[model samples]
Structures are given as structure tokens and as C-alpha cells.
Target: MDFMGFFTKKSSKDTAKERLQLILIHDRATVSPELLDNIKEEIMSVISKYVEIDKDELEITMTTSDEEEGNSPALVANIPIKKMLKRR
Candidate 1:
């Protein structure tokens, strides 16, 4: 029996892990849900001024990494650009 292939479906644990990661990242960055939303909106507004983007698919999140410079929080944004607007 191919037990490994039989249980290829995603498990609840995977979902929980992803959720927990988001929670921890937000917590570590000291960002509230409302603040995160506001930041995302502002980013969209600024970027939209320069290029056409897929607003519906934009994603913004806070990420932290430990490096030689110490643990630093970084704003991670994934904005899909559809096209660049021509300059006046």
C-alpha cells in the first residue's frame, strides 16, 4: 500500500503553523491589524502613482530577521505591477 501518497492532503497542523507564524511576526513587529491595513493602503496609494498594480493581489506583512546588525523588523510587500504609467 502507498501510504505516503494516500495522505498527501494538507493537514490542520499546516494551517495552524502558518497562522501562528503570522501572529508571531505581527506581535514581534508590534503592529496591530488596523495599523497593518493602513500601511498597506498607504503603500498602494504611493505605488499606484508610479505604476499600475494589481491592488487586489497586493500583500503586505512585517518580517524580522536576526543578523549581524541585530534583529530588525522589515516591511515585506508583494505588489504585482501590471504596467508602468507614463510620465508627464
Candidate 2:
């Protein structure tokens, strides 16, 4: 039984969902896609120093949340770590 296979494979549905989310985020924020890529790169560079991560699988996005002040935009990131490297 290859349970890991089931978990590792990315379905078309998942890909589509991610794309849609990115599009919606860009439309709402009025930000260029290039800006998002730059943000992702900068974030990965900083985080990489603390842990071993799967850079290819990193996900960063902007989202809105309901708060006391009103709807607030948030930067969300899902970084998959392969392992944590000890800092010297």
C-alpha cells in the first residue's frame, strides 16, 4: 500500500483552486503578479536560513479577514518544510 503516493499527488482540481485563488487575490489587491513572485522569493530567502524547506511547494497568498476594524487584508503563506536545520 503506497499511502504516501495518495498524499503526494496533486490533482487538477487542487491546481485549479490555487489558480483561482491567486487570480481573485490579484484582482482585489490590484497588484502585479511580479510583485507577488518577488514577495515569495524574499520570504523564502529569509525562512530558508532557519529550516530546510521544499521551495518548489511553497504557497504564498493574500486573503481578507473579518475583524473589529473591518475587513483586513492578510498575507498568508504555507511553507512546506522538509526538516528543521539547527542554527550554528
| Model 2: per-residue Cα lDDT at residue 59 | 90
The per-model lDDT (C-alpha) reads 0.87, 0.85
Model 2 Cα lDDT, one tens digit per residue, 1-88 = 2878667868899889878976887788887879889999999999999999999899988877779997666788999999998998
Residues forming the 10-long window of minimal summed lDDT in candidate 2: 1-10
Model 1 per-residue lDDT tens digits across residues 1-88: 2879657876899869867888898898889999999999999999899999999999988877678988778888989999999975
Error of 2 at 25 (Å): 2.8
What's every prediction's RMSD, in angstroms? Answer: 6.6, 5.1
Give the runs in model 2 whose Cα sits over 4 Å from its true position: 1-21
Candidate 1: Cα lDDT at 75: 86
Prediction 2 global C-alpha lDDT: 0.85
lDDT of 1: 0.87
**Most TM-score-accurate candidate:** 1
Model 2 TM:
0.70
